[model samples]
Each structure stands twice: as structure tokens, then as C-alpha cells.
Target: MDEIKILFLSHTVDYSKAPYDTGNQFIQALRNNNAAYLSYVQLYNKYGHYGAHHYLKKYVRDNGINCLIYGSSPSEFYFDINYLEKLRKEVFLVMMTGDTEYYYEIRDQYYAQAMDLVTVNDFISTFKLRQIGINSIPYYAYYDSTKYSKNGNLAKDIDVSFIGTLHGGAGRWHNIMHLSANGINIETFGSDSPNGRITFEKKIEIINRSKINLDFSGVSGKTRLTRKHQIYKRMKQIKGKVFEYTMCGSFALCEYAPGLEYFFEVGKEIDIFHDKEELLEKIKYYLAHEEEREKIAQKGYERALKDYAVERAVPKLISIIDGLRKTKTYKPSEIYLDEEFIRNYTTYRTLLIIRFITQLKFKFAFEELKIILKYRKLDLYQIVIFFKEEILDMFPRIKSVLKSIFRRQ
Candidate 1:
């Protein structure tokens, strides 16, 4: 069969790493799938996407783009509707990221209006979208472990080393406390996860050198303590880290969650933890049982090569999209909504507005009021992601305030 010409639109070209990113996954997948001309579309240099949404028309029209796979971002929602109408048969689908409410503004309005189906990277999130009356397909970004297989060798230099982020949240603190208290001599080999604090090569080095490489998925805050929806993606979404760890022949110690079984036969390929007591106990037992650990790692390595290749998975992704296009024609529903509600009330923007108004009204109590109000209703992870992106800008300004900011990036 002739390869499909598909243009993928993403907010990012890459997430800068193997475990949590889609870029490496897609590039390798296309190669494995023998996908002809699997071009990825990103809008960093070609002007802001809102503007490119207009210009992309000319580009899409000129190029024989058989199918359009749109990715997430508030600005990258709209396509060249005018040109798409002209080549009405060409643009096949729109894949929107529905993980956060950042896209929710135009989700029901413009996004669902532009494409055939919704694609959620998280299976649990996809089910949530379906539960809330929106139809979506669950798509997981996979890995081509050929590279890892080539470099998979355990040289006993480090006993236990972690290459993920080690700052933020109670879990992060817990990790720090445990590592410190245990005196396991475990090096915080990589920077931090939240801040994306490690290099890809460094990751391989850490896994290769360390006998016991940690794979804690972190806690997905529950409904009583936190909203289930937000926690679901954090814990349930099978990260490439899980597979990457397995592929590198590192003995993984992970938390039990959805989609894990898809990769490994828990306790065989990877060891899982249920609680702190179980985790510490398992780590001790596995460290002692060198032969058993090696056997499990070898098993995981075989399984990763056999089951979790880019070629095997990418076709599955395309097939899901193809199936969606087949079952339901890509007729986007035109929607109308109040512009006021969709207003971009960014965290910085809101603070700026508040600061300007407060300075004019009162100066003495404004600082106190601002401090009290800022913590009242902001999603913590949003703050973290935002800080990670704009840390340089915010660093200088808030250096005095965030004295103990433990950023690993």
C-alpha cells in the first residue's frame, strides 16, 4: 500500500525527552511504519499560530496534504477553513488535547467545530471526555526501543540513582526525606521531573550505572484530597518512562496504575509498589536478589523489543484515527459562545490587572491581599508548568521572594 501523507500539528516539536514526549515517538514510529512523508507541523518560527492559522491555508493548499492531524494549543485550534472547504476532501481530522481547561474555552466552540474526532493522550482522560458528553479516541504515544536495546547494559557504578525531577509536591518531599533518611547513598543523578531537569544521555547513563533505577509514577491526588480528573492523568497515563525504563534493561520499581499491564507482567518485568512499607521492603528484597532482578530485567528487555516498538504502535494510532474518520464523517459543528467567558485571563495577566487596580486604590494592604488571593484558586500544576517555561523571566523578578525555590531545570 502507498504510504499515507499526514501532516501533524503540535504545540511542540518535541518535549525534549524520550519518556514523556511524543516527538521521538512519532519520528521513530513513522520510520518503522514506513510512513511516507510523515511531516510534523510546528508554529514557533512561522509567526504566532493565530496568524499561521490564516497563512497555513496557502501552505496546505500548495502541499498535497492527504490528512491533517491538528494538536493542542488554544491558538492552534482553527485551520484554513476557507482552503479546507476548497480542498474539502483533503483535511481528514483534528486531534485536540483535552487534558486541561485551557482548551475548554474553544473546545465546544471552535475545536470540535474543525475536525472529525478528539484525541486524548491519556486513556482515563479520554473516558472522562466521553463521560462528559464529548466523544474522543484514546491515543498513547509509543516508543521505538531499538536505540535503548543497542545501549542496554548494566555496569554497576551506582547502587541507586534517579534521573527524574526531585522537587515539588508532598511526594517529592517524601522522596527526598526517604533518600536522605535511608542513607542509601542514592545520588539525585538527574535534576527533577517537574522541571524536566535531566538530559536524555544522562538518563541512559543513570539507568546503566544504577543497579536499582527508580520508576515512581508519583501520587495521583484522589477525589477527597483533590479532583479525580486531574489526578487520573498524572497516575494512570502509561508514560514512555515506564517503557523506556523497561527497554534500557533497568529493574523498574513503579506504582500500580492503569495501562502498566500493557507493557509488563507486573512483578516479572517491573516491580510495583502499593505503599511506603511495601516500596521500601521490595527495594530491599530486589537489591538482595541479584539473580532474580537480572532475570526480570532481561524478561522486560525481551518484551519491550517484542511488544513495544514504534512500528507496532504507530499503525495502531493511525488505525484508530482512520476508524474514527470511517465511523463518523469529519463534519465540525459550528458553535457560538460568549466571548467574555472565553477571555484569556492568564495568571500573569490577572496579576497585572489586579496589581494596577490595587496600586491606584490602596497600597498598604494590597500586598497582603494579593498574597492571600493568589493562593486561593490557582491550579498548582499550572503554576509549575508556567514557572518551568517562564522561569528565566520570573527568576530575576521573584528571586528575592522564592528564596528556597528548588528548581532542577
Candidate 2:
């Protein structure tokens, strides 16, 4: 059999600032298992759409790559839809998103229409994409057990722990803060945490040592929208941390969500809580009963090893790409040049143009403000305060401006 040539593309967003990441791991998994020949591409931070297209086309031709895979991205500030449409006839395109709830403001709608196969973690996002005629699969988060495994030497001494941004959880952070205030000791780490940005290996150690690992999937404070700020709506699926905690042989108490039941045996394999009271109660109970916690942790580890490990999940991804290739054959350039494609492509391009203009508007506005501040002879402290308020006030206006423009069109 001829080797399958796959091109893996990902934006730079690493939890661990390692040279290799999940995209590389996926490629490694395929090659390690004698499944495919892969080329990895990390989109350059400074490259524009034209540069990206130029490099991508050259690489694909040079390597004879037949499939393209896009991994998790921190932001979707740039994309080339026309280039993707042109390449669609020659290669199968797959997009994967590990994030579903928080940082959702960064997702691009154009991605749903461009890729041949889309794999998202949550059912809600999958449903939303499928409604737009996209082929979306609910591929839950997976872990490489080799990177995250139980260390016997690490003592399980911590009572409860959470590892993530504290500012983004909306109502959930308030509950955690309340716990901290009430004298219930909880270890934490992340950007918002006092200790600040622990290493991925240290994170695994913390998880293994803690009795219960708290995981939350809630709205971020990025937008000024009141609903995202005030509401405590539960996300429909489990977060990536759930898989990591479970894979590392740690007991997790995640925020209750609908689709988690499909992955785990719930109370048997993993624990979940709906509200602050339940979460606190579970943490207290589990801390006292080390034997029970260990039993649940072992079960979670078994489940993760059997089904959610990268070694197992990568093969399934390969099979899905195979089926996609078989089912979706395309004509040479004609499909992209057709009326439907033209209409869709026009709208997609228009959206990109509008986004570019809005970004430019924000840039010019900030520059003008800086000039005015310089001329006005404003002090540094005054300028800083004014600039902060301007940023906070300008973003919502920028969003509204874009919404109105799109609505008018």
C-alpha cells in the first residue's frame, strides 16, 4: 500500500511551551504506528494570508501531501478561504478544536464552511456547525499517558486543587473564592492564580497529589456582554482538563454537563457537581475518604487508557479521514468555480474584508489617541488611565460596528 501523506497545521497555543505539541504528537502517533507519512506546519505569527498560501502550496506540492489537519488555535485572526477551496479538490481538510466553552469569542465561523471534516469537543458546537451544513464530529479530548502518568513518589497530600485562569469562570470563580474565604484550603495555579503559570509536568503532579481536581467550563470575561459575565450556564461537554486529570490517575470533580455521561460511567468512574454546595461537599467527603477517591481515580485511569489515549484516538482519526476521502470526491476546479461556490465564497471573502477594515479602524483609532495624548501634554499616569478606559469602551463599540455592517449587508 502507498503511504498516506498528511499535512498537520496548527496555530501556536501551547499549554506547555514545548517545541513539540499535540499536532506533532498526532503526526508521531500515525508514523509510530506505521499508518502515514506526515508533515507538520506551524503557521508563522507574522505571515499574512498571501504568505501562508504561498508556503502551504509549495509544501503540499513538494511533499505530495494529500490530507490537511488543523489543530487547536488560540485565535482566528487570519484565514484564506479561497486557497482552501482551491485545495479542496486535491486534499482532505480536517479541523479540530479542543476548546468549546471559554475563549469561544476567538472562533471563526468561516472555519465551519471551509473544512471537509470538523472535530469539536462539545455537542453544542458540533450541533451548531452541522446546522450550517458542516460535517462535525464530537471527538472528545485525549491524552498521551506517557506525558501524563502517575508518579508513585508524589504524595497525595493536597485536599482540593484547581488549575486554570481564575478570571474567566464567571460564577464558578466566585464559588471558589468563597471557599478560600471560608478557610477551606485549596491549591491553585494559572495566570490568575497567585502562584502563576506552573509547568505541565508540575500540573500533573498537582493533580495526582490532590484528592479532587476541580474543572470548570464557563464563559470568559473577554466580552463586556452581561450574559457571559453574570450567568452560570453549564457547558454541554467536559473540558480538556477532565481527560488530563483522569489520564494521570487523579480523581476529578467536574462541573456537571450533558455529554460527559457518554464518555465516563459518571459517579463510578468520575465525579461531577452541579452547584457550589455540591462541589464543596464532594471535595470534603473525598478528602476524608482516601480509599474511595483512589478507587474512582483508578477507574478513570482505566477508562482513559482504554479509550481516550492518543495512541487509540489517532487510529480512529485516520479511519475517519479514510472514510471522508472515500465519500467526498471532487471535480478539478469546476466545483470551486460553480455558482453555489461563488456565492458562498463571495460572502466568505466579504466577511474577511470587513474584519480587516474593523481591525484597521481600531489600530488607527488607538494611534490617533496616542497622538492626542502626546500633544495635550498628559502625564503618564493620566494617559495610562485614559488608555485603559478607552480600550475597555472601544471593544464593545467595535463589535457593535461589525454587527451593524453585517446586518446591513
Candidate 3:
């Protein structure tokens, strides 16, 4: 097949502008292999939606881009009816989301409606999307082996270490405290930790130097989002830390989560823990049996390079894109807000209400809001914004409620 031109839209959170971003990694792999004509536009921490849509359209036309790879949800991008209508006819939109726990509820509904295909990092997330009639693919995180390989010179002196968020109520601190009390010494790193803001290079170093890299999904259970949904099912998705530590030649003792079985043999290539007691047991067993830990780490590294590296994964992604193009259909730029679509996807509908309220011209906004409100389904934030915008024109009851709120304030 001829080279497929791709425009990657990355939702970057880190302000450091690291070169090892997931989008950059995919781009480099494609470029390195002479696989495709690839370009990227980062959405977050940089451009507003209008600016994003402008550049996205320009790049699609100028480059004759065949595919657009969204690193997260399309909601993160500044996509409107005009851009959606124009680009859907030209480029196949593909979404690659790792954090299904957060995105699936709020952002993914937009992805479900907008994208040609959606690829998630876990099987559970993939299955859920497919059940909703989405063309979803199950994919795992890929790291560059050349950048993340183990250094023999770095001493594996640290027995246990974790290098991500310690807060946001995902129960990392609680688990860490439990393990610590049970006699496992884990060196913590990240912005929330005392070690603080390590570079990507530093992350690789730490991973290589640790005997057992303790990995957490960094999802807090106490959050309102989780409480409102099936929290356990969300946590069933695997984290990128599994691939990262494994590629760095460190034995990963990850918390029990689904999706690991698809990549690795749980007991042979990696280990998992359920609670403090189980974690402590595994840590003690692994530490005492140095040979076992070394074997698992070695197996993980081999698996990573052979099967999970970006070099290996990108070709497959390109192949999928190529296949998707062969079967591509010319879809009109219609904003999908069908009743069944709205009823099935609360987050998508809620986002539509907000986007309609906040993004459209004023003349269009009121009419759109009234239609959405008549639908009788909205999130708390959307409702607040609705009242604040006076979309209801303060019906007698709503006016009294607003008056009471103001009196309290």
C-alpha cells in the first residue's frame, strides 16, 4: 500500500515538552520505518478549540492526510460542526485512549460518535465500546526500547519504587502506607512525592535501578466520578506503567487489574498483588529469590522488545488504518444527536449541551439549549451552567431556587 498520511492530535498534560510523548513516539516510529507520511498537532496546554480546528483542517488539506489519530477524546480537540463536516469526508479519525476510566464517561461519548474507529488500551474498555456499536480495537501502550532499555551500569539497589501520582484518591498512598507498615520500603517519585518532577530520562533510570517497580493505576476511588459508576470495572484496565517498567528491565509488581493477561503471563512474565497482605507476600518472595525476579524482568524485557515496542506496534496501527481507508465511506458532516445515541450516552449528551451552550453563536445557543433541556437529561455541571446562562428564562420555581442560592451566597 502507498504511504498513509497521518495527523496525530496529542492531549499533552506535562508542561515540560518531553520528546517521548505517546504521539511523538508513534510519529517517530512511523517516520523511522518509512511507514507513512506523519504530522502532529498537540491540543492541550497549547491551543484553543478554534485554533486546533483551524490547523487540523489546514494540515489535512495541505498534506492530503488520510487519517487523524486522536491521542485521547475528540472533545479535547476544538472540533465543531464545520470542522467535523469538512474533515469526516477526507480523513479517517482514529482515537487512541489509554485512560478509559476517566475518558469513557465524559469524553469518549464524543469519540464514539465522531471517530471512524476507536482503539483503547484495555480489553474491557474495547468490549464496552463495541457493545455500543463502536468499531473498537484493544491495544496496549508501546515504549521505545532504544530509549527505555535497561542500563547495566545502574545499580538495582532500590528494592521497591513507584513513580507516579500519589494523590487523587486512587488509593496509592493508602496502599503504600499499608505495605510500609507491613515492612516493604518503597521509594516514591513524582510531583506528589518528595523526590519531585523527574525527567523522562530519570524515570527510565529509576525503573532500571529498582528491583521491583511498584506500579499503581493512579485512580482514586473516593472521587465523585468513580462513586457514580462501576469503579471496579474501570480499574480493570491496565496502566502504561506495566509496559514502561517492563521495557526498562524492571520486575513490575502491579496491582491486580484486567488486560495484563493479554500481554504477559501473570506469574511468568510479571507479578500482581491484590491487597497489602498479598503485596507484602509477593515482595518478600521476590526479594528473597533474586533469581526469580531477574528471570521475570528478563522475560518482560524480551516481550517488550519483541511484541510491545513502538517499532512493532506502529506497523500494525498503520495496517489497521490502511484497512480502515480501504473500507472508508463518505459520511456527511451531520452532528449525531439521535435519541438512542443520547439516551445510551449520558456524557456525550451532556457534552453536547455544554458545547452547544458555550461554543455556538448566541442566536443558536438559546434554541439549542432549549431543545437539549427538553430532552430532560443533564449532568450537574451542565445544569449549573444552564441556570447560570438563564437558559430556562427563570421559570417561577427556578427563579425561587436561584434566589435561595443567592441569599445563601
Q: Deviation in angstroms for 94 in model 2?
A: 1.1
Q: Which portions of model 1 miss their true places by more than 4 Å?
A: 1-3, 11-25, 28-51, 73-90, 96-115, 132-137, 142-146, 150-153, 179-185, 192-199, 219-238, 331-341, 345-409
* Residue 111, model 1, lDDT: 45
Question: In candidate 1, how many Å is residue 190 off?
Answer: 2.7
Residue 156 error for model 2, in Å? 1.9
Candidate 2 lDDT, 1-409, residue by residue in tens: 3445676675343535663355556656766655433222233322334545677777778877778776645333235455677777677887777555533332433555667888877766677777767778888644677987877788888888899888765566787887787667898899878889987778878988888888886655543212332343444446777888888888988887767877788888899988788877887788788898899999999998888888888887777787777677664322223332223333333333333344564443343344334434323433343344445455887767766787789
Report lDDT (Cα) of residue 320, candidate 1. Answer: 67
lDDT of 3 by residue, 134-191 (tens): 6888877467888878898988899999888788446688888887888887899987
Expressed as tens digits, the lDDT of each residue in 233-332 for candidate 1 is 3443344566777777777777665656655798788888766667677777877899998788888877776666665667777776666555555443
Report the Cα lDDT for residue 310, model 1: 60
Local lDDT at 186 for model 2? 93
CA lDDT, candidate 1, residue 205? 65
Q: Pick the candidate with the highest lDDT.
A: 3
How do all the candidates rank in terms of TM-score, highest first? 3, 2, 1
> How accurate locally, in lDDT, is each candidate?
0.54, 0.66, 0.69
- True-structure lDDT of candidate 3: 0.69
- Best candidate (score: TM-score): 3
- TM-scores of the candidates are 0.65, 0.70, 0.73
Listed per candidate, the RMSD to the true structure in angstroms reads 9.0, 10.2, 7.7
lDDT of 1: 0.54
